[model samples]
Target: MNRPTPAADRTDRSKRTTGPGPRGRTAGAAVLGRAAALGGLVTVLGLLPWLSGKDPALALLRARSAEQEPTPEALAAIRADLGLDAGPLGLLGDWAGGVLRGDLGTSWVSGAEVLPAVLSGLGASLTLMGAALAVALALAAVLAAPVCLRGRATAGTAAAVLASLPEFLLSLVLLIVAGVWLGLAPTSGWAGPAHLVLPALALGLPGGALLGRLVADALPAVLAERWAELWRGAGVGRARIVRAALRRALPSLLPQFGMVAVGLTGGAVAVETVFAVPGIGRTALGAAKAQDLPLLQGCVLALLALGLLAGGAAAAVRRGLLGPALREAALSLPAPLPHRGSPAVLLALAGLLAAVVTWGLLRDPYAVDLTARLAGPSAAHPLGADALGRDVLARLGHGAATTVGTAAAVTGLSWLTALALGFLPGTAAGLAEVANALPPVIVGMVVAAVTGPGTAAAALAVTLVSWPPLAAHAAALAQELRASRFLQAQRALGASPFWIATRHVLPAVAGPVARHAMLRLPGVALALASLGFLGLGAQPPSPEWGLLLDESADYVERAPVAALAPVVALGLLTVLAVRLSHTAVRLRPARPAPTSVHTEGKTPLATPAQ
Candidate 1:
């Protein structure tokens, strides 16, 4: 037989290890699972009218004419006309059948076909999202280039700061500075391409920063690989090597990219509301407020489809990027690089936030002075006055208590729930994968429908959706630890499952999960704010940050400071959270290596005989 080269031998080995048969089976099973999940979601949405406990006939009557009084005959006639007299099961079956036939039903409020309206809104949102994704990718490449090439620490810091800014606040700032002050772009509405510039930048900049940081953190390992070294030794150009490294790094980053895409879809709600863009998110909010279940259901289903498509696209790209050898091997990404720079900046931001909250608390936020309405900042009104002449400083202070306190509560509750469910990694991870597609805004709509819109409703909505990430993290870490060699050795020593989990697993999982949850606190606050901005959370006069932002929009030109005040507070809070989370991660105790088995230096338990 002819002697085979080493490369051929390696290729053959890789082919054997990859086993295309198993890969195809896994892919098919995944598709089936996703389809089943989608079907279940569709079923739940189809039955929503019944589950909401609100009479569609009564809601329709109110929508048509609030003056109309309900009578049994009129209700029956309305139900007959709308085909709602069908029992819940019948309605579900009919809806399911209609969906299969490409009919999304008609809107109760507008008397329009739900599918067309939903598609129009989805088209708008997709246009905006596409532009935003471009901006994000461009920004990530620019920011990460320096770090990847030169390992510049400053680039990472810049990315962190940029990433820390909340989407709503950034959008408003962009609207004011870029749209109002410089006249560089349209402030609101979606009449033309120019209208997209500000909102797209607003949405994409932070996401790009986040993505760039991930790329920067992961590229070092890729560049250090033996193939990269060999290429460099063979006189490969730096740019070409960097490009290859990026492609290598991309497979690991694809999942995060999917998350960022879904986040863009979810975040369109707040951005759309601010910019007056008629996207599906805004449409869904309107339908929710109107109790138009058909329209809302159509909007929700479209969003879900978009989310699933994003995830599938990411997976496809990842598979394309990885070679068979890499695909079959477990890729352990390096820990995130430690943030460089002084804690003083973080402390200074914390101090500023604290001062604002303290100064506001010292004054009465509810007190109104019509004479001071729209007044500029002064000694008495440090942050100026709102339209109602209430002290902006006082409101900001009090709002912190409401907004931040509720977010903290939601985070704590979510952490507990994640911990409780994390023992079942398979179930928790699967549920999280499905739930990840349901954004907080959508969840808020459902909760508002059931509980009515208020601060409590907003809190409940946020709590419902916030646990998935934490649970997913805990589950992933648990799975990783269970497969570790030390854990196998422990099992060989006759340790009970509970003992192994409690002694080895919980300690390894808790810190990271808690940090992850802490990192999400700002996002929870932002979600609550988004709900309030959409009028689904804290009503008028509550001074919730989101409500404050909403109230300040009209006066953005007259008193930009009023808007700037809340934006600054939110920005500071975000920066502080990011800094603290990073610090915590850096300070966390490292876990023992897989082969290490020193357990408090006690006499080792004897291994069971084979």
Candidate 2:
């Protein structure tokens, strides 16, 4: 054989020397990011026992056990019997060892194996989730089809309105139309596919709106890509281009799918509560109420594990699907997005929130006259009274206040706290990612259990669950903005980190923070509702919407309309919240794509929206 050519030798040397270059580094960073996020989640969960304290769980254990002695020795014996005597390390070791052997322990309340019981509920939850996910995707397609078929201007009209409403309120609307007005399906109870339709529709709509938005956002850039230009220059048809655009846009949205899943799964608590579905949410609700840590932990762990898997799958898909052009655009200056959603819808939502807050403040929900028990709506009582003579309308109003106020508080706290938490460089994303992986209901339960069930506890729980996404989004955006020229100039000029963050990073993060806050409202509201239904929210005599619904479950026939009044109010708020979120999303200033990503001699193609 002849001596190796210079080019071939150079290529071999290059290959050998360039191992795990930029792309490899990126992949490794992604893996580490995932691990870090998962670690944060584990940290939050591992600290739950300490954070929540052992007393409540111990008391619950005591009540479950037949021994009636109140001595410290007896309690310690009970704790020992239940395996609570071990230190954290030992406990973790035992738990890990058991998990390795396929043993998830037994429920304190049910005395059944935790794994099998949770698995039984998992089947139902997954079925419902699957049905809901499918409907959401289909609805998204239906919403986006016209935008692709028509010009991109078609995005901000009816679709914006549809996308704005929260999932629970949508569920209520479907319930009324399908079950009451149209009489096509049962309003409550899980019978078969007919009963499933309304709840699935409710659970799916918000997600559909999210998916639609993602599609709309992704479409413009996708159509502007070099590949799309090549296809267009070759005289490709609109249908083929639309298909190709959708394919390209979808992968970018993979990370978002996990975020959407939080809303989807969390939203299910309300859906399950209202539709009376015997799914895992309902089961988890029962476990939470009873303060059965073993069962609750098992259920939450299984659900969280599933969520982690879903998140990982989406990340992998995103990694695999990101083409060189999109990757180049990744470092590109974020593009300035066109205003694409309805502002009027957002105004309507804001008005409704004001109404709820006002109505709740004016109403005296706890005033019990005892004369108008189980009364119907009339001039004397506009929304009627419950079995205990509390005004249903007043209770509904107060409940609305609690729901909306708590959500607002949660929203405010999330943003305020986000500024601080997001200030941590590099690690903020990991913390946010971990928080995103956790289920809202699980967080709510832990907070409530620790704080001992009250409106404040409920609010705090909701805040903890809802804040992570905002923090993550803000941190990610802050990081991106930090790489900007102005920030670099500020840094070079010797400006303080805080000054740069406040002046530049915070402002950049503000719009996204606002948009995310709105989207979180419906989910947060639903979370409050769920916690109330589970008896961990709004102490008795202090009405909340979910609490009102739960209290009147047995009185549905006595005052059907009154029982439904709170639900209708919740529905209204949920709808408004959804609308506001979508509308706020419209106002987001589009990030400009960095021009430096492209090589010399070729300009990027113009997009249709441009």
Candidate 3:
């Protein structure tokens, strides 16, 4: 090749100088793409009601006007009055203009500015989240010490038990025991710091169990690595080594903690309902049921912001834990546990089934209260009375019946959907991925628009939105398992694809899929309660925990125990379900041999080699 002239080299250098580095250009492009996607999502959310073919005029007239049957002329008049007759483009313009001015319009139900309502709810939610996080982290830190130092199984067991407890169920149990059993804390509306105690613990403990277990397991594993032995040989104190191990393991735990934080926030729907605590999550449930577009949009946006904040904090914490030297390594962690199963599911199912039978055979939940409007718990009315003077115990029994039946139905339907669709290939993956992208809240709203509010609508909503994630996961696992040698041998032997799938692939993945389905049940429980709280699930006097919560709020101070009975019952059921999921996951062997040594049992990294 001929050497380039000095003048040619100078021109080439100038051209290179003006171009950006690869990463810089890539990041800029990503930012722009995200902005465009967000804008599109906003437009879609703003027009969701119209997109669903729900008529705002009819909805408003039904909610606001006294006339049971309005004439066509009246309906048209109301539509114009609300300016809901605007075309899609026009509505978009109006909504965007209001958004720019920091206004979210008035709520159809409350007739108040959306900003104030959202802000009020935000304050309560922030308080709950802050308290819950503090409690969880503190408790976990303390519990972690024993596991890191002595490999205490008790600490891990505690975490497992608590993590399996449902957030709502925990709140309910605490409320009843504290307010009714011992007459300890105020269980009704938020008054002062006292009210925060039980809810905070309920919200925090489930997360604490997870954090403590991870921290405990991770620290021991870190200590067992080869490098740690060097420090041990150098006569480094065990305490210092423990601290070092913690610093390494902590970085890995923060991301999960962030998820726990979000769960605490979203899971607050149950806690807030039980305690009559006004929070954005509860407000979102309300807006969805009423089909209040502006209020629901505002709540969704606020929650999205909160989620982003949690994510940012987790990232920052991860970076801090990584430090400069370990920065590269910290970015990478374990991908996933390929297989996990638990046998506790059988125990949980049996226990819950027994409890359901007991509740049904014990009393009638629909018996009306004849004595007092809101009586305290006593022999006559063990759970007390509602505002309508209904027997709290009877309603609770009926609620247990309704709640159990609904949960079982939803779980079976959702599990079958996941199994059927996930077993397929091409079309199943694409469909699941699409469903995964849509928010569950939006799906609930859409379903409500079609079916109106009832147990059926809520059940459908939960089943539809919940199955996609599980299906996507199961399908992916199936795809991975199909590549194994045994499956391949069957395939090469001329076995039909369907036969191989059923006989081999299905059983191989069934353990993990079943556990996964169980894990999703607590979420389903929350969805049911949320829909009920929002007036879309169990109607009044139905005894569904969600409906019980809604109907009991006003009478909290009057008959705290009656108002809280459902919380206790629902919480126990939820705790059982969670335990079932965890137990199910634990039953599967991690290695080919059940007795194979695990990382937790391994000696510390600093220990001398044999």
Candidate 4:
């Protein structure tokens, strides 16, 4: 028998050792690469605007604001202060230099160093986001645990229904009905614990609903597992079985909290704004409106950071709890798909919001004579008019329009901002994540307070709060697609990243993004309406939905319908969008990947010839 040569043995060992080590190295490289990319992006994000002295929409904005051009002296001061006089790359270098020296520049408006101002805003945003997330987690546990335990179709259905409604809309409606109409809580101002209720609810509802679904989905699977069956066969108590199942489901399920958190953050901005809560989301809004590039950039960067942290936390938790299969599956799954359709739905929604604005502008809410007002609802106005005696129907319709309109506009604008940010190299995704982790109401309050109030300001505030999730998702999806074979093929075919993202990946992910976006509409609408109701949106007599509800609260006994109309519309629109998203996913045919497991042929320790 011939003995094996050392070279052959070494080669064989090398082949055998390539399993986990190579994969581990690859993962390490990926992590390092990601870190480097993020670092580079952070540097660029901090510097680029200062270098260009322009925002992404600077041209369009400048064209509109030509009359408001800064004087040469002011411009020079601004340029010197912002480092815009330096060439673009040079400015980037200067900004980078300043950053290294711990100088983030001062706020153009405040004259305070940018880092401290940013830190303060960041702290407020964190506080609000943390509170909101805690509230959401608590609510999710309270609501989802019971429904999952029940394990019945009705419980599942109830959970689904709750999940279907957007957080912003639900919270806004409650804020109006519970806070304004009932006068149970302060509608606008940041009071005490009472004020937290509506905003928290706005944050918690959608998150809780999503958690419920995640738990529900995970629970049943866990319950059916061999371990669960073994425990059951061992005569474990039902409660014990539930506990075991939940324990098993924990890892698979918990990561969903991050996604839910992102969704809630999106809603919280508007809620905060409507309620006049001061926070980072509001600051971001102010920055966006003022085109305070540094402030806006800071806000975006902060948002992305928060998202990364949340996502990372969720991932860590998930990995700690769940099996590899569950972890991979949960992370790999794209957000639930949305219905296939044109931008028509979005456009229509925009129109509706616009119509409401027009109505509010046109309607003379002051003309109603108090002497003509009856204590009860009359035929002239089936639903009793407000103290102003404006037709309640018109008011309600217009209110719904304004509230929903503002939300729609904000959502659209926010999504666009998010998309743009997502496309940027480096820190964009992280910034998006941070934004997603924030609360909209807080953003709104700060922006409104600083910039003062107007449609432009309000819209900007809404967008700042609303855009993070969309950006995170877009960036995430793009990253994922970039890794896929199809994308690689396109790249090999000489397609640019932009072209690939726009042509192939966008179409593939559109259904899901659209669904998510649609699902978000009601919440946005509700938040917007809540703002109107609170008298922060479009101002008084704007006939905003939330405002109408607030105004009609006293007359609910006389005109329940008037008070309920806006609520009903909000609810219906939310339901329709959610359903369409669900249906889109359900209707799509599943395409399974081909599985192949390599079979190794075993050789005897020694060949018979040896």
Say which candidate scores most in TM-score. Answer: 1
Candidate with maximal lDDT: 1
Candidate 3 lDDT over 1-610, as tens digits, reads 9988999999998988877764355345445544555566577767755665666666666667667677799889876765568888877777778778988776766556899999999999899888988988888888786766675434554565566555555676677667767788888788899989887887787777667766765665577767679999999998888878777667766656665655565566667766778888788777876777778878876776675576568768888877788764514333222223355665666576566547544876666656668888777776677887777777766666676678768877877887776665344444432233333444455466556678888788667646654465556567667768988888899999989888887887676767766665655665677667657676765778778876775566667787767666665554454454444344433321111111110000000000
* Model 1: number of backbone collisions: 0
Cα lDDT of candidate 3 equals 0.64
Candidate 2, position 545, lDDT: 75
Estimate TM-scores for all models.
0.84, 0.78, 0.70, 0.60
As a whole number from 0 to 100, the lDDT of residue 607 in candidate 1 is 2
**Using TM-score as the measure, what is the rank order of every candidate, best first?**
1, 2, 3, 4
Q: Model 3, which residues run further than 4 Å from truth?
A: 1-44, 51-83, 88-101, 109-112, 173-199, 273-278, 315-401, 416-451, 464-476, 487-523, 530-535, 548-568, 587-610
Q: Is candidate 2 or candidate 4 better by lDDT?
A: 2
lDDT of 1 by residue, 1-610 (tens): 9988999999999988985573355445445545666677677788877777777787677667789889999889988776677888888988888888999987888767899999899999999999999998998888777766685534766676677565667788888888888999998898999999988998788778778877887887677778989998999998998888878778867877877777776778778877889999889888888888899888888887888798789878888888776775545555555667687887788788888898899999999999999999999899999999999999999998899899989989988888766665444545556656666777788778666789999998778667765665666577678888999999999999999989989888888878877766766776787788788999988989989988997897788787688877777766676676565444333542221111110000000000
How many pairs of residues collide in each model? 0, 18, 18, 33
lDDT for each candidate structure? 0.75, 0.64, 0.64, 0.55
Between 2 and 3, whose TM-score is larger?
Answer: 2
Model 2: runs farther than 4 Å from truth? 1-37, 43-78, 151-177, 180-183, 186-195, 224-230, 323-360, 468-530, 552-561, 582-589, 592-610
Candidate 4, position 111, lDDT: 45
Error of 1 at 307 (Å): 1.0
